[model samples]
Target: MPKRIQSSGRNIVLSVRDFCEREKDNNAPLIPFGNVRQRVAAKTGISEKTLNKAPTLSSTKAEMQNWIINKGLSYLPTMVKAQLYKIIKEHKEAPIYEADQMLQAHCHKVARLPPYHCELNAIEFMWSLVKRRVANKNVGQETNNIVNLAEEAFQSITAEDWQKQCEHVRHIEDKLRERDVYMDAEMDRFIIELNNESDTESDSSSEDSSDSDYSSLAIHMDHAYSK
Candidate 1:
């Protein structure tokens, strides 16, 4: 994990090493999620606390929102998530203010969506779908072959199939929105009560949009393969 970006809300550190070890225990298979995690964290250290703080598989939709949107994702408040991410990955030291300004612009341009309304950005499901579709199909062992395989995978699906997938995803999203509305209402009431007691002007913030939720969703997969 990069110490530079670790802060109140924006850090979601992934443990590629543990992910690799877990995959090793299973039969070796093509797992892109674990591979990406390993690639991202190769030079940087993995912090146990950051990874462990992630909600477990059984977490409810409301809990997931509280952890991911309200607390976990640093997209809010700070603003410059993309630049900060670049600094961590590229090992370039830059002003957080620049990143902050960039993020503020993004937030300004986009309307916030409820947490549960964005099933299209659920990366874990996408990884499973991709791996199942591409398993055992060799695009050769060369780099170009790998690139070709990715292109083929995207091109293989029909427009109708894509529409069906998006529709199904949207159905789940509707359910999520209902849950979020109920939860958000309760939270808002609590905040109002607190403010009434304190009698101070509370600062307002926006929720993350559905389209932008892609970057925050975490997917874990095994990456051990014959190399």
Candidate 2:
């Protein structure tokens, strides 16, 4: 729900704030400047100072907020973010040149980034699929046989299977786009309802609130093979 605007002289912050307000859904997380800093510190394990020096991403608070609100949300878990803070803070006392190097190493280990990418994410989907297909029975008692089973499975995927998978991805992408549009429209409708209810407080209004709750992509992503 957060967006980045060029850090405008006076108007930039306000525009960002206003956009957030207009578009915020009932369940949207708050995206204040202070909250963003705290979240970043929690995610990177680096001191705010060290995070400031991060080059892969811009350091501006709005940019950070936008990145997290959009891209990072799927990758970084709350627990992981806290651990990142610990790793960076502990390593910050090292000499300047060494500090960056140490922090970078720690970051790769700490940052979960995207939980899934193109459905290939090991934890998100593929691992479970493999387990479901093969885990119940041992491939073999010995290591070599297990490796052979894995290689055989990898080689089993055929052209027809790949075509079906591509079609499935396209269908998923279309559904996701529809869901986003529905959620956005729902937010606007909810706000309008809220305004109407407030204005008609003295009168007994019986209209049912419109149900705009379309399932979000997060739920789709989180819901893989359930244990």
Candidate 3:
């Protein structure tokens, strides 16, 4: 069983490092930074001269170009191509589990909720109730007693309460899906309207140009007749 630890910055980093170590021991293909840099250089066909002039990892591509210029080096096509390749590679490799083989190793699947959607987690609701109960209780001064009270608060939430929270989350998911569908339809309509407006404006401009041309021709004919 995983130990229930406080979510401090150092603790979180330690936990991630431990998880990574375990995954590494299991023969997970975790690419190192040096390997990534070498791969980026090889795949991009960027020369060492341009790559050497690049700024720190935190700097943007444009900023890196500026840095290169500051170092009396031009940001050539090779550097720009390398930057693009780096961005594409980073985006493509963003997934935590890259291989389908990794998923086969685990018996039970982990359901990862979308980012910023904490309401979908039944544990969040359970924690809220537990914290409220703990706040109401007068477990004072003793560390062991406070721990006991906190434990008791957690124990108060039943399986039925978890089921209800799950149902609530399903309802929220349905509503969100409905809203997304509506927004997509609205976006399609808006794009069509914009295209129609553009076409109409183009036609009006062409008609105006044609009328101007005709007026100019009439003036030229009049000048010729008078002469």
lDDT of each: 0.50, 0.48, 0.60
Put the candidates in lDDT order, highest first. Answer: 3, 1, 2
lDDT of 3 by residue, 6-70 (tens): 55645546655665676579795444557764434443444334455434466677765565555
Stretches of model 2 off by over 4 angstroms after superposition? 1-133, 136-140, 192-227
lDDT of 1: 0.50
- Determine which window of 10 residues in candidate 3 has minimal summed lDDT: 216-225
How much is 123 displaced in model 2, in angstroms?
A: 12
Steric overlap count per candidate: 4, 5, 0
Q: Give the distance in Å from residue 177's predicted Cα in candidate 1 to where it truly belongs.
A: 1.9
Please give the ranking of all candidate structures by TM-score, highest first, separated by commas.
3, 2, 1
- lDDT string, candidate 1, 1-227, tens digits: 86675552233234445555666788674355666544443423443333334444454544444544544353344534443343233432222333455678778442344565345554445555656566546635665576666667667766676666767777887897899997776555442112232224233422454333444444443333353
| Candidate achieving higher lDDT, 2 or 3 | 3
The prediction achieving the highest TM-score against the true structure is 3
- State the displacement of the C-alpha of residue 211, model 1, in Å, after optimal TM-score superposition: 50
lDDT score for residue 7 of model 1: 55
Error of 2 at 84 (Å): 30
Between candidates 1 and 2, the lDDT winner: 1
